[model samples]
Target: MYSNLDRPPLNVTELRRGLDPFFSQLDVVAETGSTNADLLARAADAEADRSVLVAEFQTSGRGRHQRTWVSPAQAQVALSVLVRLPGIAPADLGWLPLLTGVAVADAVRSVAKVPAELKWPNDVLVEGRKLCGILAEVGTTGKNPTVVVGIGLNVSLTEDELPVPEATSLVLAGAEVSDRTTLVRSLLRDFASRFTAWESAGWATSELADVYRERCATIGAQVRAELPGGDRIEGTATDVDANGRLIIDGRAVSAGDVTHLRPLE
Candidate 1:
């Protein structure tokens, strides 16, 4: 499936070689409707644990709250992973996305040699502009639940190509944009290591809460949360709870569109 990619196939080959020690299997696709969509389909047909799907371009990429994620070929890293955690209740699945955000933030800081912070819910920011995004979808079979974690990172996009004015790429943020292969490998390695630790501890929320708080940019700032019920709550971003919900002014918000508000100088 990866043979016909617009970029050289050796990039993925190199990535696979680097990640050989960490992951059991990796699947690279040249083009797809969406990496998350493909992995979910594959997971439903055959339960493959720790499987990865990466695409150079996504024809129908998705974002949080059903937003569209569009990126040009060789400009971004679009990937998804299929994870199976046993004995984990459905109610506790919110941590998956938060955990993934922490992973991505760590990877970007380590690889790009620049600081990156996470916005509540699952957005990575550099210089207060979005550099990456994560979407986690949990689906349950008869007995097992599958979590497909999808990540999209802007690597080397021009200002005109950015979907939103608030978005920025690694290069734009004054960080060196490495090859796609290196970026993907580094991200997978960090995620796999963190996820292993998280699962082994039975999805301990306290362990991740500290790391998330340290790397979060929204905490202690005034922000606006666009709630699902068509109401907006503007408050100080306080903390993230054990369930990974963002605490705004002492209120636990599980789901909402968070917009960081300008602070008064």
Candidate 2:
């Protein structure tokens, strides 16, 4: 049996002391149903901008398309961040999740020392195995709508504990997993920096697209994208467009479930 003791609790106090000034609010709970949901509810408040929520265990964590994400207690980094993006246009908002993917991949590569690449539309992969999933939801709470970005990163889950066979963890990828505090800090800081820069540039995509392209593994690969309405498209992915849509076979896909047909060589 895998004891929960092996995965210790996060140091909320230390995290707050380190991360408070950047975010309007930073909270860490022992457990929650979903950090994204909680943060979305909080977005109704006036001071919800830059609010960050983290959970040690999620009872009802969800991913894109309502897919449930389950993991052992204290085995993953389940977190959500809310940012008021009144300045950014709705069309440009698609970049938020992709930006998050780049930040997460960078964090994993720097902290875990693993080569983390990104699957289009925001799945972090290590050696072709999914290590994290990102979900960004829009909340029309105040005069300016808010965007809550949720990230779930596997830190120490064993093979049997994975939600899917294609999923992996830092430990399984031969990375250290004891100090989740550091990983959390790195992820938050990196995201904040990139998001701030992107917003400062009036939601421009030049720099963000460049960074996303460099870290994205789906580009330059054969892909099968299952679009909405039960339609699918198969082609070679060439680029991520200026608006953050996956460009597959000359088609700019705004939304779809992309699957790589072959491994990254």
Candidate 3:
């Protein structure tokens, strides 16, 4: 029962109208195969860093674990932003996904007017149903390297458009506003602020950590983590370590698919 509604073309002029200091360039395309891959290929370009590429519709979008992500055409906020951290300690690169998660939660709460929280590394959930997915990829190695962070959010999709039973859209969450443009602006605004603070502090600050813990829905939850190489563990998620890894039962999980268990478990 999906409607004939397609997202209106992103207003490139309005997006670039004032121009925030964090981003030097912003390009909105009518559509693309994959914003992450597209930006990754261009990461070496001088203008690629501090630049943004937003696709109105992603033909080949993906999520964690190479899971296919599908949404109604133009009915989501699908964009990738590039950043270069020059002289940044490589150890701190793990925080980009968490940082992006925090910013996405902030934007979702502010724009959608819903109670949104982060699911560990980078999933945004409202009432336990996923609303957004974020993927952070590192590209190139040098004094300054690029990390492209991409976020895909379901904005106005109807129930029939959901790609998974566990997924929900902003509209389904009773969001007060489902305008893609507004959500994009708010997300970029919040991300820019957090990113600037993180960069200014040389990635040694704890503000992002503190804020992430406060907004993280996974911490303190009994969970099961499916790690790479066919390893699995179940325990209560204690805290996010300094390296941004999920600490569970004295083990640090760098990458995994976490499933939150019920309270009685």
Candidate 1 lDDT tens digits, 1-265: 4332434443766877788465668888778899988888767655488888888788899998789999877678899988887777677787888888888888888888768999998899988899998998875544468889999998877899898999998877877645678778888888988888888888776887888889999888899999988988999988888888889888889899999988679
TM-score of 3: 0.95
Scanning candidate 3 in windows of ten residues, the lowest lDDT window is: 1-10
Which candidate wins on lDDT?
Answer: 2
List lDDT for all candidates, in order.
0.83, 0.90, 0.87
Candidate 1 weakest ten by summed lDDT: 1-10
Evaluate model 2: give its TM-score. Answer: 0.95
Tens-digit lDDT string for candidate 3 (1-265): 2234555766777788745788888888877888999989988886668778888878899897788887767788999998998887788887988899999999988878999999998899999999999998897778887899899998888888889888888988999988777787888999999999998888774888989999999999999999999999999899998888999988899899999998774
Clashes of each: 0, 0, 0
Model 3: CA > 4 A from native: 1-6
Q: Residue 126 CA error for candidate 1 (Å)?
A: 0.7
Q: Which stretches of candidate 1 lie over 4 Å from their true place?
A: 1-10, 20-22, 141-143
RMSD of each: 2.5, 2.2, 2.1
> What is the descending lDDT order?
2, 3, 1
Task: Please give each candidate's TM-score.
Answer: 0.93, 0.95, 0.95
